[model samples]
Target chain A: GAGVSQSPSNKVTEKGKDVELRCDPISGHTALYWYRQSLGQGLEFLIYFQGNSAPDKSGLPSDRFSAERTGESVSTLTIQRTQQEDSAVYLCASSLVAGGTQETQYFGPGTRLLVL
Target chain B: AQSVAQPEDQVNVAEGNPLTVKCTYSVSGNPYLFWYVQYPNRGLQFLLKYITGDNLVKGSYGFEAEFNKSQTSFHLKKPSALVSDSALYFCAVRASRLTGGGNKLTFGTGTQLKVEL
Candidate 1:
């Protein structure tokens, strides 16, 4: 079975520009999540989606960060007016159920974003 | 508030020696603890988790973790380390309170494990 997949294995965008990163979760996964990993740092939670819409967007660093999942399958994370600090490895994960209690999440390869 | 702490930044050991990676967590309710390993340029892979029952939990690649409620720690261990086992290890925790939002997992800064021959 295919695990989660993220597009644009690597992206280099200029600061102040907008960048969109895509993720395709495994089939039938109802819960999806986004996280960022800076160099020598841990995974930082960003946002989460359940059934095509996000209910917990608290982890988003700022208003400039947003994400949307369509058809409960694919998700897109958009960074508006990217800052140099936004440079990191963006990771996507998904789970079979929306059980926000104790389910394990499967992660994707992640897309590395570099803001020059 | 929920959080996890990996006290050590790195752990070095010989290939045939025992290895241990320590993790401590703070949460409101009964905590669900997990261990994950990440190779360079790859996503994190689930190693093992501690839900309930026995204090000793076994996981992938001959790895295991012992849960100690009194100490508030879950330490990963392996009988013999392998050179290939060198990577970044992370400890995560999620409270079982069933909040309205979702099961948000809190991760530690991660520990780098280096196994030399």
Candidate 2:
């Protein structure tokens, strides 16, 4: 089976420009999550979606960061007015289901975004 | 909030030697600890996880992790190191759903493992 997949393996953009990163979760996965990995830092949680439930935006660093998932298929993380600080590898992951004891997330190749 | 800590910034071991990568975690309830590996320019690959029941959980590539509730730690280990095993390793923790925690995982600062021949 195909694992999670992310598009635009690399992106270079000017500061203040908006960028959207896409993720295609494994088929039948009901949960999707976005995370950011900055240089010399741990992966930071961004947002997550479970089925049709309202997405969990608690991890969004600021109002400029937002994510949306249409059903359980695809998810997009959008950064409005991107800042140099937003430059990092954006990773996406998905699991068979959310909040289960056996749930284990599979990750996708990240989209590296460089904001100058 | 749950959190994870990987104390060692890097671990170097000789090939054929045993290897150990330390990890500890804190959470409100039972902890679901996990280990992941990342090769350069690649996404994270799941290694193993400790959910419950067993203290020693075995995973891919001959890797295993021990869950120590008393010490609040889940350390990754392997019987023999391989040069190909060198990579960035991450430890993550999540509070069990019974505790009303969300699905997101809290990751630790990664630890680089280098296995030399």
Candidate 3:
């Protein structure tokens, strides 16, 4: 079975530019999540999407960070006016269920973003 | 308000010796604990989790974790370490309160495990 997959293994963008990272969750996974790994902040959850419901954006660092998951499949994380501090490994994970103790999130290879 | 802590940034062990990676967590009620390992340039792989019943939970690659409610710790252990086991180890925790983000896991800074021969 194919695990989660993220596009653009590496991206180097200007500090003020916008960047979009894509993720393809495993087939039939109803819950998807985005997280970032950085030297300064370690690992932090960015956002989550569960079948058709309003996405949980509480973990998003700022307004510039947004994500959209359409119909329980693909997800896109966009950072508008990226800052140098946004440089990090953006990871995507998906689980069978929305939220529960039994939910085990499988992670993707991650998209490394370098905001220069 | 749930959080996890890996006290030591790194743990060094001999290939044939016992190894232990410390992990402590703070959460509201009954906590669900998990362990994950990450090789360089790869995503994290789930190792094991503690959700109920027994205090001792076994996981992949001969690894296991013991859950201690009184100590608020879930330490990963292996009887004999392997050189290939060297990698970044993360401890995560989630409270079973069923709040909006309560099920969302909180990970520690991670511990670097080095197994030498």
Candidate 4:
């Protein structure tokens, strides 16, 4: 089956610019998540969406970061006024369902963002 | 808050030799432990996970891990190593859903494994 996919494999932008990264989860997946991987921060969760309930944004570092998922198909993570610290590889993942603690997450190739 | 630690920055082993990568975790509640491998310029690939019922969990590519509640550890191991196994390894932990921790995973800094032929 098709796995999770992300767009704009690489992105270079100036500081203070905004960027939008897209993710298409596997077919029939009801859970979606976004995470950031950087040399300094390692891997950190950004946000998560389960079915139609409210999205979990507790892991978001700041208000400048936000994500939206249309149903269970695709999700977009937007970083406003990006800073040099925001430079990292943005990864997306999904699972068949989110209710169980045993569900394993399948990851995407990720979008590498460079803030110059 | 849930956290994971991969104390070693790197591990080196010869092909056909046994290999082990250490991982320890701390969480307020019972943990959902997982191991993942990442190849250069690629996404992380899930290896194995320990949710419950078994202390020793086996995963893809002939990898296995033992969940130790006493030590709060989930070290990944393989009987024999392959040069192709050279890559980055990550250990992650999420607090059990019973604790209301949600599904977010806390990952370690990752350990680079170099399998020499």
Candidate 5:
């Protein structure tokens, strides 16, 4: 079975630019999530989407961060006016169900973003 | 609030020796714990999880984790180590009730494990 997939494994951009990262969740996975990992740091939650309900944007670091998921499939995380502090590995994950506490999330190979 | 801790920055072991990567967690409610391994330049791979029932959970690639409620620990262990097992390890925790609508995961700082031949 195909797993979660993210595009543009690596990205380098000038500071103050905007970047969009893409994610393709596994078929039938209604729950999608985005996380960030800075160098030598742990994973930080960003945003999550379940079905067509209002997305959970609580983890977004600031107003400049946003994400959208069309239906239950593809998702995109966008960071506006990126800064040097925005550089990190962006990771995506998906789960079959979004309601349970025991649900397991499968992760994708992350996109490494570098701001210079 | 939910949090996970990997006290050790790194763990070293010789091939064929028993290995243990420690993990502890804290959550407001019931805790669902998990373990993951990450190879360099690769995505994190799930090793195992502890939702409930049995305290000892078995997982992929001959890996296992033991859950201790009193200590709030779920440590990853293997009978013997392999050179290929060297990688970064992480412990994660999520609250049981889905009341908040967030249900986000809280991860640990991570521990680097090196298996020497």
Candidate 6:
């Protein structure tokens, strides 16, 4: 079985530039999530999508951050006008289903973004 | 609010010695606790989880976690530490009711486990 995967293992960009990070979830996984890992903020959940219902964007730090999932398979997290503070390793994960509070999430290698 | 605490910033153990990584959590409802390990420059790997029934749950890579309802803790343990076990450890928790947090796992600050030779 293929695990979750992310694009652009490393990205270096100037401040104020927008970046789009892609995620390919495991086959048949109906739930996808994005999280950020930084030196200051250990790991913070960014957004989540379950099936086709409304996505949970409560964890998005600001309006500049948004994500979209094409159906239930692929997801992209975009950070508009990126700031130095936004530099971090963006991680994606997926699970077999969405509920029961016991679902295990398989994680991706992550995209390391560096805002210079 | 659901939360997890990994009080120790780091834990060091010699190879062949027993190791423990402490984790405590808080939630409005019953908790689903989990443990994960991360090596440098890699994604996190699931070690084990405690949902119900068993207080002691064994998982991959010879790792196990004990769920303590009274102490609100789920600590990862290995009978004999190996140098390869050195890595960053994270503990996470989710509420059973799916309210408040809504299946979103809350993770700890993480603890660095250094297994020496």
Top candidate by TM-score: 2
Binned by DockQ into CAPRI classes (incorrect, acceptable, medium, high), candidate 4 is high
**Fnat per model, in the order shown:** 0.53, 0.90, 0.57, 0.82, 0.65, 0.50
Error in Å for residue B62 of model 6: 0.6
- lDDT tens digits, residues B1-117, model 1? 888999999999999999999999998768889999999999989999998889999999999999999999999999999999999999998787454324777899999999999
Question: Candidate 2 regions off by >4 Å?
Answer: none
Query: If both were scored by lDDT, which would come out higher, candidate 4 or candidate 5?
Result: 4
> Per-residue lDDT of B1-117 in model 5, one digit per residue for the tens?
788889999999999999999999988767888898999998888889888899999998889999999999999999999999999999998888643525678899999999998
Per-residue lDDT for A116 in model 3?
89
Give TM-scores for every candidate, taking all chains together and pairing residue i with residue i.
0.95, 0.99, 0.97, 0.98, 0.97, 0.98
**Colliding pairs, model 5:** none
Write one digit per residue (lDDT tens) for candidate 2, span B28-64: 9899889999999999999999889989999999999
- True-vs-predicted CA distance for residue A58, candidate 4, Å: 0.6
DockQ numbers for every candidate? 0.62, 0.92, 0.70, 0.83, 0.73, 0.68
lDDT of 3 at B9: 97
Candidate 5: stretches off by over 4 Å:
B98-101
Q: Distance from true position, residue B117, model 5, in Å?
A: 0.6
Per-residue lDDT over B1-117 for candidate 3, one digit per residue giving the tens place of the 0 to 100 score: 889999999999999999999999998878889999999999989999998899999999999999999999999999999999999999998777554444467999999999999
Candidate No. with top DockQ: 2
Candidate 6 lDDT over A2-59, as tens digits, reads 8999998999999999999999999999999898999998988888899989998989
Show where candidate 1 strays beyond 4 Å.
A52-54, A100-102, B99-101
- Candidate 5's TM-score reads 0.97
Query: What local lDDT score does residue A48 receive in model 3, on the 0 to 100 scale?
Result: 84
For A1-116, candidate 1 gives per-residue lDDT tens digits of 99999998999999999999999999988889999999755688888888745468989999999988887789999999999999999999998866544478889999999999
- How many pairs of residues collide in each model? 0, 0, 0, 0, 0, 0
